[model samples]
Target: MSTTVAEVPDAHGPTPAGSDGEELPTRPTPRRSTLGQRMRREWQMHVFILPGVLFFSLFAYIPLLGNVVAFQDFSAFRGIFGSQWVGLQNFANLFTDDEVLRAVANTLIISLLQIAFVFPAPIILALFLNSLIGERIKRVIQTIVYLPHFISWVIVIAIWQKVLGGAGPVAELLDLLGMHGVNIMTDPDTFKVLVVSQVIWKDIGWGTIIFFAAIAAIPTELYESAATDGAGSWRRMWHITLPGLVPVISLLLILTVGNLLTVGFEQLQLQQPAVGADAAQVLDTFVYFRGIAGGDWGLSAAAGLLKGVIATLLVIAANRIAKRLGTGGIF
Candidate 1:
């Protein structure tokens, strides 16, 4: 009649049966806390995002409900509730509308230009900057370039107008060289090029920050190995640096495609009058004119909705293509 002791099993695993022909008791499993309990415990952290949540709910997500106006023959006086439901009439008109079609075409052209020129500008700049040996020179160059990104689109346009306009330095240089009246700012044929150039100048440095980070993340060992294997600077960069940037490049490309129709609302609207609808007039400007100026709110909403859907579809398609091509997508 020796005293008996209850042997508890280890928390990690159950133990074998004891000599007394009874299994050891296991430690009790921990119970999961309820959502309410977790929230209460993490209330302080939640407080930080409370304002952003409220702001988006009020200004972003909640207003999405107004998209219903796309279907209704909406009027300011009659209101969404009182407006007549015209079903798909507004959407149908979008395909038949010349203005909408023109906007779509221009948007597509500008989007292609941006992807070709603007998207890669940053990657090249980052590589060039990363190749620089002087940290001081690199810092100064980065500061100067990134400063333009903070400037307003209005100022950016103004700067470009001064440099490329009829009386700008470039025009004066052309005038001196017997190529008089070579103004690009007002030239419709070159307007798309101007837009793409402006985007590159402004955001290239900002975009490079990500690429520089990606390059930094590449293992120095790979570069050393490549160098030891008789690889030159270009060879190492091509094999190591370029591959490291693929994931980031693919992700940003997907996001850029999603905004395919956007093409900078402020930037395009400010230049549309100068270039006219033929060379400018993106989808955003079309919506502005139709909705606010022309008072065709329903048709405008329909066009807006249509563009949004197209952008969304493009993002999905681009992401799938990226994934299939072996680079990871944003999703």
Candidate 2:
């Protein structure tokens, strides 16, 4: 007697029956891992993100908790928990202070000036450089310009002091020419000019990188096609290069608006004594002087909190405006 094997049918779907008319064997259902097992599988990815998560939590979120100091009369002797709650007193102090108003005024004036003068400079510079024929020379010039960005603000200011301060080279030249030696470094009258110029010198090169990158990303075929259509370098740039950079420009503009009040704390702080708070007082410096230096923690924290809130709103408004204007927004 010969025996025959009969296959069982698959449970998921129909399958061919055996000669004995039995169904084929079905595949087993797949089982999902538990939450713990799933987490274990992604352990490497979690490890990679852990350090950054810790850093942000410590440096960013932890400090944000200190903003509570704005609501309390904070003192070293009386810690955060021990401080007396003063509700809106700190905020009130900010509104009533004349120096706070002056600081805000100075910050806005200088930042707007920077936006007007310094912002578009790199775009122009990049375009000019892009139009040049020699790649090696372009690279060399880019490197030279970008070098200043790496220099510390302290050193940058010191160098400016040497060049523009009284008895320095520029002042000495003016003195020798029978002109009154004006102290650019310590002069309240010229502080805005000095700060703006320093900002341009330090950042213009760094800013050029983005514009240059944007310009470079434009297709060579576009330029070739434009040339075929009787377009010159200037024409091609006007039509192609500038349009390509519009997105980046718009994005940076929005960001700059957000940072308008963030006019250099260290820069102003370093120069404040020489130029006096009247000329050099920006919001950041005011916070440092009043909060950290003078030990008025509550008032400083309140002022800082207000500044941050305003800056955030400005960024949101700028982003919305950009989107409405048909430009890419930061979000």
Candidate 3:
């Protein structure tokens, strides 16, 4: 008598009795909505971002096309398209120009000073504010800090002038004390320091808002657990708070490095008369004076294009370093 055999599944379907038990592969179902259909479904979300998208396209991306002037003997009379192409001549001039090089050097020096001093001031302030037990006091302090950020640069500069200029209160105090009063506003040696101080005083509070928010977003449980384990305030901050702020810090650092060459056009331009271009000349002012005032369109455009390229590369390099360090980057 033959033994009863069980049916076995195979590649296609259930196999006949005594067949192998290999299973069939199933095909993935096609997605129900096409990309267009999906976009249409989320039309409102797209609408929400449309204005921002359009604004950048118009002001940022569109202006990028003008960089072609960097490669041409650009003339206002002939216009960008009518201008004769000069290949690398403009770039050559940019690199060889003494004023451009000087501007670049000044920009680097000022930017480094700002990064070293101004960058960390907000974080320190944020930490101090965060550590405060009284919410009402913290709110009042934050408001005071944030107010300067809302003040125009012109007004801020005026205030600084009134407080630290040759005849200002500090100088007056020095005069009363029988010490020599210094004109800080026009002193080239101290211009970089003045710029850094202004940046810290004006934007430090606004900068703290982000760091404070980041600190607030950190879970209280982490701090509570650390405290339960007998960790003191400094230990808790070092272990929990700073680690939580790494992502935000990394992001801001990347942005700061990327903008190393910028160094505040309006602020620098306004102060140039006081300190003179020898000390205050930066890439932005160089471009403004060379292109707008001196009518050296091609040269200025080349300088700007170079600055933009360097800034873009800095951002890329910074992001890469951040990723390697295991911190979240802007990318």
Kindly indicate the candidate among 1 and 2 with the higher lDDT: 1
User: How do the residues 125-162 of candidate 3 rate in per-residue lDDT, one tens digit apiece?
Assistant: 99999889999999999999999999998999999999
Instruction: Name the regions of candidate 3 deviating beyond 4 angstroms.
Output: 1-28
Best candidate according to TM-score = 1
RMSD, each candidate, Å?
Answer: 4.6, 6.6, 3.5
- RMSD of candidate 3 to the truth, in angstroms, is 3.5
All candidates' lDDT scores? 0.92, 0.91, 0.92
Poorest stretch of ten by lDDT in candidate 2:
7-16
Model 1 C-alpha lDDT versus the unseen true structure = 0.92
Candidate 3 minimal-lDDT segment of 10 residues: 15-24
- What candidate 2 gets wrong by more than 4 Å, as runs, is 1-41
Per-candidate TM-scores read 0.92, 0.87, 0.91
Candidate 1 residue lDDT tens string, 232-331: 9888889899999999999999999899888898998899888888889888999999999988999999988888898899999999999999998888
* Minimal lDDT window, size 10, model 1: 9-18
